[model samples]
Target: MRELHEHTTTTAADALGEAEVAVLPTGSVEQHGPALPLGTDLFAAAGVATRVDRADAIVLPGVPVGVSDHHRQFHGTLSTTEETFADYVADIVESVAAHGVRKVVVVNGHGGNTNALRRAARRLRADDVAFTVPWHWWDNLDDLIDARLDTSLGHADAVETSAMLHLTELVQEDLLADAEAGAADSWGREVPGGADVGFDTADFSDSGAVGHPTDGTAEIGAELVAEAVDDLNALVDWLAAQRFEDLRPAPHR
Candidate 1:
């Protein structure tokens, strides 16, 4: 499939009429853990989004920056106000809509961006704009993640690190080997005598890798990719069949 990054104006235009959907990867750059790069969310979303089998639909460049106000307490964090972020995203959809795309899929990776996108999508719809829905990877893969992961080295924990390992072998994980099964607890308590310290990724281990790196391998990441691609493709098919009002009776029905 041709990627948006590789297409000329004409090719891009042509794909619009030919393709049923347009994909926009939405991600963020902030602290994950010492073991993972700040761009982990961005790359993970990219890895999965690019793998979608949308024949004529080309993958566009992802939104690399996002609202990171929560992570602003950490170093090297760049965030934008929610309003600014929403405007930026709205502009993206509007710019792409100029093409023949009647449907759009914003593949969101960060947890923070979901509500904002929801609000924006609703507003756009209320204005009679044409578009598809925002699909959050975390929400979509909840069933998969729940079956595989427990509440342990979370946030910058096991699942995320494993994904990075699978997508790029060069990812930093020198400290992942020290993962502590349960770092922080949901009750706002800490695991007693855990190897980790304080931080979103802390409590799991000193360097912020949660659970066990021993449990993580490139193979698992590959499995996640397979599952994700399969499910997302199904979602794309469903999106293609949707109407602005599935609320009304269909002619066949």
Candidate 2:
């Protein structure tokens, strides 16, 4: 694994010089019901990032926290303000760019970080620091996911549980049955005469889980991981061969 955190300064300098893109896995530390670990997001992103077959890519250490304020009411969830998260992400990209890596790919595992990542990408473009892109692993594999299960992705649900089972040993398999039994089919509250409103996970699910956890399995998880890694590998290969100037903003009309 060519991880930035594991490399020596000299080795990193050499790797960066030869690398086309720096892959940074962004995840959140949040509750994943009773069956999965709180580090599910982090580990999922890191696992895929590390496994992708790209010799021209340098994988950075995973971001352990993100904009997860919605999950805060569920104990063990850590969060940062949206602004703070965006700033932190931008700073990381700028730092990597400083090392001469002109392209950066953020392998994101949390939905809450999407808007912040987009904002950060805008800032990077304005500053001409690097060509930055955020990729949500789930979004990239919708077809495969749909074929594997009828339910869409949800917090600590079948998708997440399966993913955690594949990527790490942190899942408490003994609790899977109970967790699945208590899982909710949907998120937040739906009103008859008003828009759906939700402040935290507690508002919708006492079990801290949305979706059917019973459907998850290590086999499905492995398949999901493989699909994501394949997609990411293709993206990196495409981006690595592009010219920076071509991707930069066009000259003012």
Candidate 3:
């Protein structure tokens, strides 16, 4: 693994010079029910980012906190404002661009960070500082998730639980039943007019989880990670072959 933090300044200078893309993992330190650890998202993002064995890509240290105010009612849920998160992400990408690796792939693990990440990516592109793409591990895996777990991505659900099992041994295996017992059938509470009233996770789920947790298995998690890594490698291959100028925005007609 070409992890930037593991390299000395001298070694990093050479590594950065030869790298065409920088992979930055971003996630949240938030509640993942009783069975899963608070760092579940971070583990998933970092796991995927580090597994991409590409000589032309360098992995940066992960951003461990994100926009997770919706889970504030749960313990150990740390969060930052959307604006703050966006600025932080943009700054990181800008710093990487200063090192000459302007092509970046932000491997994201938290759903709440979507808007902030998008805003950061757009700002970086507009400023011509970097070309950043926010990629979720579960992106384009809806079919596999639904087929294996019979549910979409949910907070601390089977999909996430499986990932934790595969990447780390932090899961409280004995509490899997408890997590499922308190889990909500779906994400939020909606009215007949299609209005969502569940502002906080506590409003909808007592366990801060959605979907079935008992269905998760380490075997399935490994499969998910393998597929995600393949997808990331393909993306990096495509990025590494492109010229930085071609990726930049074109002038207005």
Candidate 4:
């Protein structure tokens, strides 16, 4: 694995100079019901990123906290303001850009950071810092989920539990029974017109879980991870071969 944390100064410098893109895993330290770990998002992000087969990309150390204020009602949930998180992410990308890395991919695991990451990507593009994109692992792995699991993205649910299972020992396996019992099945309650109302997890789920945790299995988790890695590998290859000048906006003649 081409990981920044494991590289020496000289080797890192050389690698950075030649790297086509740097992959930065960003996640949250938030509640994952009774069974999953607080670091579930981070673990998923880092695990997928590190497993990607990219010789020209460097997988940077993960940002283990994010905009998770919605989950703050749960214990062990740490969060940063959207502004703070976006700025921090922007700075990280800027730092890497300064090191001559023209392309950067923020492999994100937290849904809360979506808006913030989009804003950051826009800012980076406006400033011409680099071609930066925030890739949510769950968002990109819908097909895999459809094939391997019965549901989509859900907090501390089957998908997440399966990922934590793949991490080995990160999940509280003993508590899964309780977690499954408390799973909420949907994101939130919808109004008469089908519009979903926004609220904290405590307002809906008694156990802070939003899906079926019992549906998760380590075998499925491994498949999901492999699917993610393959997708990322293809993305990195495409990004590496693109010409920035051709992709940049053209001025009016």
TM-score of 1: 0.81
For residues 214-246, write the lDDT of model 4, one tens digit per residue.
889998998888888888888899898988776
Tell me the spans in candidate 3 whose CA falls farther than 4 Å from its real position: none
Candidate ranking (lDDT, best to worst): 3, 2, 4, 1
TM-scores, all models, native as reference: 0.81, 0.96, 0.98, 0.95
**lDDT, each prediction:** 0.67, 0.88, 0.93, 0.87
Could you give candidate 1's per-residue lDDT for residues 97-144 as a string of tens digits?
A: 677565678888776677778776766665555464787655555666
Model 4 alpha-carbon drift over 4 Å, by segment: 250-253
Count clashes in each candidate, considering only residues at least 3 apart in sequence or on different chains. Answer: 2, 0, 0, 0
Query: Candidate 3 at residue 144, lDDT?
Result: 85
Predicted candidate 2 versus true structure: per-residue lDDT over 220-252, tens digit per residue = 999999999998998898899899888888889
Q: Point out the higher-scoring one by TM-score: 1 or 4.
A: 4
Worst 10 residues of 4 by lDDT: 243-252
Least accurate stretch of 10 residues (summed lDDT) in model 2?
193-202
